[model samples]
Target: MADVVRPSDRFRQGMATRRRVLGDAHVDRASGSATPFDQPFQEMITEGAWGTVWSRPGISPRERSMITIALLAALGHDEEVAMHVRATVNTGASREDITEALMHVAVYAGVPAANRAFKIAKHVFDRIDAGETGGGSHD
Candidate 1:
């Protein structure tokens, strides 16, 4: 017989944090679609990204959201940038805050990367303003 696996304390914390930041619908979609192949990846993010980094108290979720957006933008992670931008609703980050972060990204990362990120962010913001809560994956 296969033994059932209980989630760890860290995983629990991560799941809670993830849900709070990403929302129930997005988290539900991600959790529901997890296959055996990507299950470990999902677990790793829950335990690492959400549980460890995001759960830390030194910074606010708003700060983390801005930093995440900047990093994703700098790295040319278009989809992730949009996803995080959408998540700003729950993270308490304002559009002005995101614009400031992207401005920094332009100076530090590059014009091209920041420009593309700005376009993506604008599109997401437009959708959000239109009363549509869906922009990125499962959002």
Candidate 2:
């Protein structure tokens, strides 16, 4: 069985990391939608992914961000990829790092996935360049 995280600790840590990475507005919106049905899943992710894995000592956040981007891109999870792209800055993953990861994804995952990931990344980067809170563009 996986080591379960305490609910209180998970919520606190997850909310903190989420706010740091995704910004307060995004975390607020997500928190606002918490319902009985989805709350458990949210907690699980908060504890397991955000608190446990992300907070682990094995790898730097930048490396984790790179791995996350690659996995999300390869899986064609556009929304998640976009979210992580926004997290790159907070994780200390430069635009160049993201570009390199996507290029590797292009070779291993497929050009289509890489292309779509690039487009999403570009959109996020553009938003950043435009002084928007969570958007950025590569091109």
Candidate 3:
């Protein structure tokens, strides 16, 4: 069997990344709604996705953001894609990287998914540019 990974470190690192990428307001909203049913799941994501995977030393956050954006777009996860899109600003992914990722999604994930992802990304970018609070900060 594979080694069982403890999540303490992952949780801490993931929380930092989550806070940096998603901002305190978004994190607060997520934590605020944490119920008995979802708390465990939330922790799992924090430790596993944010902490372990995202905290790995292999790639820079910018590279990870690009890959994440492409994957989310391809998977038709528009909301997640949008969130990550906003995260690109902090990761230094630039608008060009996102455009290329969406283009790849259009080719591989289907135009519909790419279209929706683009729309959501645009909206998020607009909100960010407008300096809306609660949308999270990159740094």
| Reference-based TM-score of each model | 0.96, 0.85, 0.85
Number of the candidate with higher TM-score, 1 or 2: 1
Model 3 C-alpha lDDT versus the unseen true structure? 0.80
Worst-scoring 10-residue span by lDDT in model 2: 130-139
For 1-139, candidate 2 gives per-residue lDDT tens digits of: 9998555876678667767766776767676777988878777777777777777787888988999999999999888898889888788999999999999999999999999999999998888888877432110
Higher-ranked by lDDT: 2 or 3:
2
Q: Mark the regions of model 3 whose C-alpha exceeds 4 Å error after superposition.
A: 1-7, 135-139
lDDT of candidate 3 at residue 57, scale 0 to 100 = 91
For candidate 2, the per-residue lDDT at 82 reads 87
Model 1 lDDT per residue over 9-110, tens place: 999999999999988888888888889988898999999999999999999999999999999999998988999998999999999999999999999999
lDDT: which candidate is best? 1
- Which of candidates 1 and 3 is the stronger one according to TM-score? 1
Provide the RMSD of all predictions against the true structure, rounded to 1 decimal.
1.4, 5.8, 5.6
lDDT of 3 at 130: 94
Query: For model 3, which pairs clash?
Result: none
Clashes of each: 0, 12, 0
